[model samples]
Target: MTEVRKGRTAKRAASRAVKRRALAIAADGALILYFLFALFPVVWMVILSLKPANELFSTYFSFTPTLDSYRTVLGAGEDEGVPFVRFFVNSLVVSLGAVGLSLVIGLPAAYAAARWRFRGSENLMFTLLSFRFAPELTVIIPLFVLYQQLGLFDTYVGMIWVLQLVTLPLIVWIMRSYFADLSPELEQAALLDGYTRKQAFFRVALPLVKPGIAAVSLLAFIFAWNNFVFPLILTSSEAQTVTVGALSFLGGDRPKYNLTAAAALVSVIPPLLLALTIQRYLVRGLSFGAVKS
Candidate 1:
């Protein structure tokens, strides 16, 4: 009887283990399918970019690949295209600039929001987040008129300033949460050691959240970099970023899908490289910020 009881228990445990493994396998299979579905368009675009213009529409997978589209966009081919390098630079500058400005302003604001609460504090934070919820188009027309009036149209400074809408709220809210998660006792201890509040923040509390800052900054930069409607209506040639510049290949004489694909792929390089380089810091930041102290 004892031996039979032990055998039954072992069989039940083995059956449960099999079910768990089966469930895990099913979940992984679903995730893989989703990844492939999401990646299909990107792969197709890359293939289109590599194919010769004449071969672009001929077949999906059976075409002679060429570098002519890349060469054209980069100004190495006989057929000239937009100066994509300039657009790439403009994107880098505007995205980085907006994120920098947001950090300078939003960091302190986030700290204040995290550390203290005054009247209308919740309302004010709500107002900041509201910027994220509102459609850019709702304000773009008025902004266009205002930009023209203020001589901000098609200017780097203007582009960076406009992107505050994208970066500022994100930085403030995320950093606010991170700062809140950190224990106030750490900063208080520094204050007792004769450090000023500012010094305590700069020397003690700030260093602890480095991971969160790096992750959020990278995210904000990507958002600013990928913004399309802003560049489309706000900038022309002089200050346009890659988001708009890549589309230029699709215009005039005849549509150039191959070159458009190449330009699109080229534009992805900056964000992808940046994300890869900072991936470790981003992961660290996320992990560190998640735990409440």
Candidate 2:
């Protein structure tokens, strides 16, 4: 009887192990399918960018690949080919400027909102956040008129200012939470150590939330970079960004799909590189202060 019971127990353990293995396989297969689905468009765009104009319409994959499309998109010289490089520069300036301005202003505002109970604080935060939810189209017409009046249209400063609508609220809200999650005791200790309020923030609180800042800054930069409607209407050429400039290929008598694809791939490089460099901080930033100790 004892031997029979032992054999039965062994069989049950093996059955459970087999079931676990099947579940794990299913989960991995599902994840793989999702990744393929998500990456299909990017992969197809890369293939399109490699094809020459002559073979762009070819249904078969036997055609030779060429770099002519990229050359056309990037231009032979700074002033020779398309102005895509200029547009790329404009994007960098405006996006970086917007994110920089938001950090400078929003960091203090977030810290204040987190640590203090000023009157109308909630209302003020809500007002800032409301900008995010409001559709850009609702105000773009008036904003365009204002930009024109102020001579801000097609200017770098104007683009950065308008993009505050995109970057500011995100930094404030997310960083506010990070600040709130921090213990007041730390700052109190800083004060006891003879640090002024400003010094306490810069020396004590700021370093603690560096991860959140990196994550939020990356997000703000992406938002500013990808903004299309503001640049499309507010700027013509001088301040135009890659989002609007890339579409130029679709104009004229004939569409240049290869050039368009190449432009897109080139534009993606900066943000991709930035994300890759700071990806280590992203997970920690997002998850920090999420749970109580």
Candidate 3:
């Protein structure tokens, strides 16, 4: 009887090990396929950007690598009137401003929603989410007219405000969930120790959710930076962002594929750099609700 029990336990353990190995193999295969799908276009774009203009359309497909395309896009040598620098600066300003504004407004609103049970709070949150999901084009005409009347058309302020609609609701929802997952006892203890509500929030609560804040800020910045339609309709040369400026590659006769590819690669650098910098915080924030304490 003792030998039979030992034999049964050994068989079960071997079966479990086999199942685990199978699962790992499946997961690895999925990850590799996903990585290829995600990275192929970016790899192709970089390859195209490195090719010379004449080679871009040549019959034999010249494989010669050159820096001329990058120089043109960066205004390094021959390309003088491209306005790359202005567009790049404008993108930074608008993206940062939009993210800052969203945090200022959304963080407080999220805190309220998470900590307090106000009337119609759920309805308000849903309304905000609805607005976030709505198509940007639907509101563009109305906003264009309004901005014209208010003299905000073709201005950085107007562009930033319009982008807030894209980012604010996402910030509120993400931060609110993070705040909810935190222990209320910490804030209560701070209050008992004579910390004002605002003080407790700024000192205790905010620090605890720094990961969430960073993630939301990164998301908001990306949204505003990549925004094309709002800037396309509302801005001209003065406030044009990298996205709108990239369209300059299109002319009456033919599209400058080499220049556009170079411009696209340049445009991708800032966001790529930012994502790499904040990748750790992003991972933590995304995993906020994955496990329960």
Best of the candidates, TM-score: 2
What's the lDDT of the predicted structure labeled candidate 3? Answer: 0.84
Runs of candidate 1 with Cα error greater than 4 angstroms are 1-29, 77-79, 290-293
Weakest 10 consecutive residues, lDDT, candidate 1?
Answer: 284-293
Which residue runs does candidate 3 get wrong by more than 4 Å?
1-38, 59-62, 76-81, 290-293
- Candidate 1, 86-173: lDDT as tens digits: 8888998899999999999999899999999989998999899999889999999999999999999999999999999999999999
> lDDT by residue for model 2 over 1-293, one digit each (tens)?
99999999999999999999999999999999999999999988888889988888865566788998888778752333358989999999999999999999999999998999778888888999999889999999999999999999999999999999999999999999999998999999999999999999999999999999989999999999899999999999898999999888877777888888899999998888999999999878988855211
* Top lDDT model: 2
lDDT string, candidate 3, 193-221, tens digits: 99999999999999999988988888778
Model 2 is weakest, by summed lDDT over 10 consecutive residues, at: 73-82
**What Cα-based lDDT does every candidate model obtain?**
0.89, 0.90, 0.84
TM-score of every candidate relative to the true structure: 0.89, 0.90, 0.85
Clashes of 1: 1
Order the numbered candidates by lDDT, best leading. 2, 1, 3
* C-alpha RMSD of each candidate structure in angstroms: 3.0, 2.7, 4.5
Would you give me the overall lDDT of model 1?
0.89
